[model samples]
Target: PHQKTVIDVEKDILYQNDMLAQRNRGYFDAKNVLAINLVSSPGSGKTSLLERTLTDLKGEMEFAVIEGDQQTTNDADRIHATGTKATQINTGKGCHLDADMVANALKGLKPKENSVLFIENVGNLVCPAMFDLGEKERVVIISVTEGDDKPLKYPDMFHSSTLCIINKTDLLPYVPFDIEKVKLNAKRINHQLEIIELSCTSGEGLPLWYSWLKSKVLAPEPV
Candidate 1:
């Protein structure tokens, strides 16, 4: 009876997740919103990357963010500092951000044109890889400080991502992360991965990333 109950609960969660995903996706379709879900482990610089992006192109895009964290509104606070409307979703014990969390958070925001919605999922490389939050694109960020072999160890995240960013290149010298090895391993898992190696602190490689992002957000989906 206990096993049956557990199974039923899991099934319900999945059903709810699916329904929310469809709804959120439909919302984006109607508004022509280009949403991106950014996933990575803690300290992977997901928020920092978004900060840099916002600073550079806030004038061009009506940018907003859905900041997911297990606790606290710290990340949302940072994003709000940039003058972008950011909604914080505290997932209590949840390790990942699901579609419902995003849908719920979207309630209070004012809609805008050609909006770029960046959902910064809770810092966990595993669970976030499993849940699709109705994003048009998914971006995975891995920092050099996290080690070079993360791609091999966490293939699911790397494989599912449309864009892979290698952050903290400014700290590459201080750390023993082999940039070449990281690329090779990541490509092994996802040969088609679009990688942007950049350091937010030094502004290194930002131009390439900036251009790539502008093109991507503006790129229309093929029918």
Candidate 2:
């Protein structure tokens, strides 16, 4: 959320949560891991975004995923089907993923040097933004079908995000979504937000996403 009250709550996450988040982030940093927490509602194309990213970045950098869901391993299976490593975190009764769950999920993973880890949060826009999973960046994905006003409606998700993705741009022709308006609304909430809008099915504007990702995760580290 853009409100100061939001920070008040985030700053006071449980001690266990803070400890684990720090530990996990430290583990990631020690391995040169760039962890990205991907958050959005179900059907917002979170998996599609991951699929596209892994396909384009596999050769350039080590990639893996932690799929969070309320009950199944479906998302993880899809990630594995793409020939990349993946872990499944079933939250059972929980709607969002927390650091402890993430730390537990990574326990069985074989160490990948210089890896880029992607944590796909349980499909929700609210609770997920409250917990930190030791990610270097938090990314939120929204689609036209979900509405262009999503940023203002879910300001917490947008405010916590390091980048915002507008998926399913190809559907724009049949939808009433406005790219400029969405960007404007998102920026009004978080003026420094970075955005990328693209269609997962048709690949329209996908290059922009890939390029943006490369600049963040694949670009040469400070020399």
Best-performing candidate as measured by TM-score: 1
User: Which lDDT tens digits does candidate 1 get at residues 8-109?
Assistant: 998898788888888998898777788899999998899999898898887877888999999999999999999998888999999999998888887776
| Total backbone clashes of candidate 2, pairs 3 or more residues apart or in separate chains | 1
**What is the per-residue lDDT of model 2 for residues 1-223, given as tens digits with 9 covering 90 to 100?**
5787787765766566878999998998777778899999888999998988788777877888899999988999989988999999999999999999899888886447577888999999988877888898898999988888999998999998999989988889899888899999999989999998888998988899777777776443464
Regions of model 2 farther than 4 Å from truth? 1-13, 218-223
- Among all windows of 10 consecutive residues in model 2, the one with the lowest summed lDDT is 214-223
TM-score of each: 0.92, 0.90
Q: What TM-score should be assigned to candidate 2?
A: 0.90
Where's the lowest-lDDT run of ten residues in candidate 1? 214-223
